[model samples]
Target chain A: MPFSVSKDEILETVHMFQMQNLDIRTITMGINIQDCRENDGKGTGKKIYEKIVRYARDLVKTGEEIEKEYGIPIINKRISLTPLSMVIDGLSCAEVIKTGKYLDKAAIEVGVNFLGGFSALVHKGFTRGDLALIEAIPETLAGTERVCSSVNLATSKAGINMDAIFMMGRIIKQTAELTGDRDGLGCAKLVVFCNAVEDNPFMAGAFHGPGEAESILNIGISGPGVVLNAVKNYPDSDLGELANIIKNTAFKITRTGELVGRVASRRLGVPFGIVDLSLAPTPAIGDSVADILESMGLERAGTHGSTAALAMLNDAVKKGGAMASSYVGGLSGAFIPVSEDAGMIKAVEDGALSIDKLEAMTCVCSVGLDMIAIPGNTAADTIAAIIADEAAIGMINRKTTAVRIIPAPGKKEGEWVEFGGLLGRAPVMKVNQYSAADFIKRKGRIPAPIHALNN
Target chain B: MEESKKLIITVLGHDRVGIIAGISNILARANVNILDISQTILQGFFTMVMVVDFSGSTVELAELKTLLGEKGRELELEISVHHEDIFKFMHRI
Candidate 1:
C-alpha cells in the first residue's frame, strides 16, 4: 500500500501553521457593566443583558476576518466581566440568579462559549453584596450554563479567611446535595482562590482580574495532547531527555500563544497581558499531565518520587514558555485537576493517590485543591485548614493558585460523583480526619514568610 | 457555523531531504495554490510557515490536512494545513 501518511507527531508540528508564525489559543474579552446598575435587580438585569450583547456583537465577525487575513486559528472567543455581584446590591438571591441568566443569555446571543465574574472577593471579610452572592453560588451555578464564578479567599498580603473557608466547605456540600441530579457539578464553574490573577484566560476560575484596563484581550494556551505526543516518541527516554523534549515542545506551543495574543490585542483595541502557557490536560485519556509522567514510567501517580517528577514538569514548562514569550503570566505549569485528568481518576480508582498527595502537588503546580470532592459534614475548620495550607504555599511561592473543591452532601469516601459532559467524574478521595482547630481558629493573615523575598 | 476560508500550511520539526518537495507536490496535485511559504531552521529545529489558497483547489480543507498530514508521517516531520480564517477568528479578539 503506497500511501502518504500523517502521524500525530507531524500534525502537531504544524498545528499553529495559520499564524504566519503566529500561535493563538484563547481570546478573552473583559467587559465592565458597572454602568448598567439600576434601582432594582430586575432593571439592572435587563441593562446588563443589553449592554453585553451590544458591545460584543462585532467580536465574532472581527475574529473571522482576522483569521482569514492572518492565517491563524483563534481557538476560543470568551468574555469576562466585573463581578455582577458587585453591581447588583439590594438584589435578593433570586434576582442574582436572574442576572446570571442574563449573562448567560448575552453570551449565547453573541456566540461566545464562556463568561466569568459571577464572583466575590472576601478574603478579609464578607460585604453585604459579597455575602449575598456567596449565598447564591449553588443556585446560580445550577441555573446558568455559562456564568463562571470565583471568590478569592487568600492572598499573599491578606492571608486566608478561615470564616469563608469554613462556610465554603458547607456551601460546597449543600450545593452538591441540591445539584445531585446534575452530578453535583456546579462547583466546577466556581473556584475559591488564593492569589487569583487578573490576566488568566482559562475558565471556571479565570476572571478578568481587578487590574484590567477598561477592556483588554488576554490569551491562554493548552495542548497536553501535543506535549504528550511529542514526548511519546521516546517511550524509553530517560528523565533528562524527557524533560528536554517537554521544554522544546512547550517553546513552540508558547510561541503560538504569544503570536495570537498580540494580534488579537491589536485587533480588539486592547493591550495584551501575558500568555498562560499551561498544559491544561483535558478529560481525554492521552491528553493528561499525569499520563505524561506515567509514560515516563510510573506504576501510577503519588508514589515516593512523584513530587520530583511534577517539579521538573512545572519548571520545564515555565523555562520553555518564558523564553518563547515575554508576555507570559498566570499559572504556566501543567494543570492537575482531579476530575479532569484521566490518570488522576484512574489513580483514585486504584487507591494510589490521596487528597494529601494532591495537596502536595499543588505546592509545585499552578492551582490548589482542584476538582476534588469531600464529605458533607467535613468541619468548616478542617476546610479552613486546607485553604490556609494552600494559601501559605501560594504566599510563600508567590504563584497564582486556586481551590475548586466540592463536598458531596451525603457521598462518603470512595463514592464516585459525576459532573457529566466534559467536567468528568471523580471518586471522592480521602481527607485527613485530624482536626486543626487552634491553627484555623487564629483567623488572621499568616504574615508573609521572610524567605519569600529572597532573590 | 461559518465556512472555512483562506488556507495556511505550516511545516515544522526535524529536517530531512525532500520534506518541502513532497508536501508542495501534494498541494500541486490538489490544484491548490501556495500564496506564500516561509521556512527557517534554528537550534536544530526546522520551522516553516506557509499560506495556501484553497480557492484554487477541488479538495476541502480537511482533505488537504489529511493529505499533507500523510506526507508528514512518511518523513517523520510535522505538517499542518488550516483554513487561514479559523485560526484567525479564534485568535483575533
Candidate 2:
C-alpha cells in the first residue's frame, strides 16, 4: 500500500524544517556517573570523561543510521549528566575548575559539540558543594570551550533567593569584566533558573537530573516555523482553529522528535527518556513567539490577551507532544526569548513589551527573562533586580527559567546589535531607567514561598 | 495454517479517518484477536502498532491481506504483517 500526499504538502514539511531543512534538532545523552566518582575532583572528572566517551562512542555512527531510517537529520549529539558538583563535593574550587576543563576535553574527544552539567542547584539554600560549584563557574566557563553551566537558584514554590541573586550579579559582572573585551561572552554559557527542568535537550543549560537511573537519552525538537506556517495562512481563522492548527503542527513536530530520538537511542546504545517537542522561538523575524501572536490576530505581543494566547499555545503543544512521544520532559513549550526573537525585539523597541510583561509571560513559557538586551547604562543593581524578579518566578513555579540579558556596554535603549545568523540581532531594551539599589542592595534570602511546605 | 501464528502488524502512511477502524475490522473478521494497539498522527502522517493473536483464523494469510490491502488503498496506508519471531529478533532491547 502507498500513501499519497500532494507535492505541495511535502514541500511544506521540507520548507518548515530546521537550520538544515531538518526537523530533528538535538539528541542528548544523559549519563549517570554515580558509580564513577573518585572523591578527587580532577580524578573524578577524568573518570567521568572516560565513562561518557565510552558510552557515547557509537553515538555518531548510530545517529547516521537513524538519519537514513527516518530521513530527518539529527544535527547535534551531546551528553548531559547529573551535576558534577553533587558527585565531587569534597574537591576544592580550583580542582572543580580543573574538572570542568576535563569535561570539555572529553566532549571534544567524543565528538560532541557540547557537554552540560558544570552546574549547581541552590534554589533553597547553598550547600558547600553548591557554593563551590557556583564559585567555580567563572573560571570553569572561561577554561573550557565546550562545557555549559547552569544553577537553579529559584523555583516556583520558593521565592527568589536574593542572596543567590546578589552573588550571581557580582559573578556575572566578574565574568563579563573578565572576558568583557573578547565579547565577554563567558556569561552566555551560564543560565539562571526558576523551576529549571531536567530533560531539556537544548543548551547552555541541559543537565541530567540526579533522579535519573544509570543513563538515558532525550531529544529536544524545535520547529517554530512549522507551527507558524500552519496558522499563518489562516489570518482570519478562529482561535479554536488556530489552536487546532498548532496542535496538529506540534504533533508532526513531536512525531519527528519521537522517531529521531528512538532511532538515535537505538543507534547510540541507550534507553530513551523523553522528547521535548518545544516550538522554540528564534530571533528570526518570522519565527518569534510574538510573531505567532501577531499572526493569531494580535497587533503585537504585549497586548491584553497575550498571556492567555501563550498559555493556550503552550497547552496545545504539550498535548500534542504527549500524544506523539511517550516520554515528554524538559521546558517543552514555546520559548519567548526577547533578544533571540526578532518580533519580540521589535515589540520591546516599540514599547509594547517590557521587562515586567516578560516576567509575567515566563509564568507560561520555557526560559525566563531570556535573551533580553538591556541598555549598558543600566546599573548593576537594576540588572540584579531583573534577575531577582525572574528568579522569583522560577522559585515559585518549579519551572526552569533563565536571564540572558546582554548589556552591550555602549548601546543605549532602542539601539540595535546584530549577532547575525542563529543568535540573531537584538534591540537594546529599556530597563527601569531608575535605580533598584535599595531593593537589591538589601541582600538577603527571599525565603521559600508558602507552597513549598507541601507534602 | 499460517493464521495460527502471533503476528505484529505495522501501519504507516498519511493519516485520515477510517484507517484504524477499517484495519481492525478486517482483523476481527478474520478471527484475529488484537492483544494491543497504539497509534498517533503527526504532521499529516499516521503510524500504528498492533499485536494480534491469530490462532483461530480459517482464512488464508494471502486472502486476508488482499482484503486489507483493498481497504489500505482506500485509506492511503502502507501495511506490513510480520511474524512475532522476526519482530522480536529485530526489536529485542
Candidate 3:
C-alpha cells in the first residue's frame, strides 16, 4: 500500500519535536574486538585501540550529518565493544587498567561520549581474566574518564553468582571511596545485570555480545515527554483506552528510530542491529518516565498503582515497537532511573518513592534500581543484597534487569550528588539499615529457578 | 530544467500583521518558489506551513535556514526549515 503524508500528521510530529522533547537518544556502534586479542596484554591493548579508532572514526560526523538533514536531534553517539575480559585472558590488573585507558583514549579520539564493554560475564563462574577485570574496575574507572563497565553476574539459566555479587559489592564500595571526592561518580559508569542483552545501545550496561556480528549499529530512541503529553490528553479514559494511546504513540516514536537506524547503518556501512524502544529520560523537566506514569492518574510515581501503570506502559511500548520495526532487541521499555528522571527525583524528594518501592516498580519496568543514590554509610552487603534482589526479579521473570546505584561518598541521606549532563543529579536516599551481611557472605551460586528448566 | 527540490517551512507565533509578507520577502529574495501555502489563526496565535521549491534557490539549505531563522527572530516568530523528506518518512512509511 502506498503511504501518504497528511498535513495534520506533519504538524503533530513537528509539535512533538518542538514542544514535547522528542529525540533519538543514542546511535551506538558495536564493534567486536574479539580478534584484537593477542598473546600479550600490551599487544591486545594496542590492537584494540587501533581497531576502535579505525571503525568509529566517522561515527560522530555521520551522526551530526543525519541530525542536520532529518531535523531530529541525535543526542549521543557512542561505542560498545566485545567484553574486555574475553580479550584480556590471564592479564594482570595493571594490564587490564592499561587496556581500559586505551578504550578511553579511543573514545576521546573518536569524539564519542562513552565507550562500554569494559565488562566480564560471570553468570556461571569467573575465569582468571574475569577476576582480574573485576579487581581492576575501581582503579580503571577512577583512572579513565570515558570508559563504562558492566558485569553480568546472573542469568535465568545460570542462576545468581553470589560470589561475583559479593565481590561486586566490595568493588562498588571501593570505587566509591576511590572516587569519593566526586560523590562516587565512578559507580555511575558501572552496571550490574541479569540476563543482559547483547545489543543494548544504552550505557553503562551496553556491551556487544558474542552472538552479535563483527560490527553493527543499534539505535536507542526516547520520548517520555511525548508519551506523557499523549496520555494527559485522555484524562478520563479507561485503562484499555489509555493503553491504546501509549501503543500508538510508541509506534510513531519507534518508526522514527527505525528510519534513523537504517539511515545511519547505511551511511556507516555497518549492519543495522535493533531499535531499543526505551523511554529513557534526562534530568530536564518534561522528559520523564515517572511523569508519564503520573499522567496515567497517579498522585505520585511511587505510590500505590505505580507498578500496574508501569507494567501496562512497558507492555504497550513493546507491542507498538514490535509492529513498527523488523528487529527489536535490547531493553525496550520505560527506564525508571532516578537521577535521570525529574518526576522520579521529585517522587523521591516527596517521600513517596523509596528504594523498596523502586524495586517493586522494577519488577515491571525495563531496568532495576537505576541511578539511585544511597547514603555514604550504606554497607557493601546491603548493596550486594540489592543486586541479588533485582537479579532474582530478572532471572525468575526471564527478562533483563540491571542495577546502577551510586553510594555517594561523605554524603548523607537528603543530600544531592550532581553528576552533570545525562548522568544528572540524584538526591541521596536511605537504604535499609538492617544488615544483609550474613546472607551476602554465603558466596555461591543461587540455584536456577525451577521454571528455567525449559528443556 | 532540473526538478525543484521541495522544502517545508513552518512558522508559529503570536498573531501579527505582515508575518506572511515578511517571510515571503525572504523567500523571494532567496529565489525560492512557493508552491503551496496554508495559514491559520487560533486563539490569536498565528501558524503557517509552506511548501517551497528550493531547486532554483540561490543559496544552500543551511544558508536558507539561517536566513529564515533571522527573519523569524525579527518578527518574534519561531520558524523551521526542513527538507520535505523528513515529513514524508515520518508521517508515511
Say which docking band candidate 3 falls in. Answer: acceptable
Q: Residue A170 in candidate 1 has what lDDT? A: 60
Predicted structure with the largest TM-score when compared to the true one: 3
lDDT by residue for model 1 (B42-80), tens? 579787766666777888665777788788889887666
lDDT of 3 by residue, A227-265 (tens): 999999999999999999899999988888988888888
Maximum-lDDT candidate: 3
Give the alpha carbon lDDT tens digit for every residue of A1-455 in model 1. Answer: 01122233223444534222233546777777778888766688789889878767877766665554444556568888887667876787777877778888888899887788888887677777887888888888887788888888866766667677766766666666677776667777878888788777778876766667767676778777666676668888788988888888778778667766666667666777778888776576676778777766678987666778888888888887888886887667888888888888998889878888888888888877788887756776776677777877787777777778777666888888887655788888788899987776666455556654556
What is the TM-score of candidate 1? 0.79
Q: Which stretch of 10 consecutive residues in model 3 chain B shows the poorest summed lDDT?
A: B1-10
lDDT of all the models against the reference? Answer: 0.73, 0.73, 0.90
What TM-score would each prediction reach against the true structure?
0.79, 0.77, 0.96
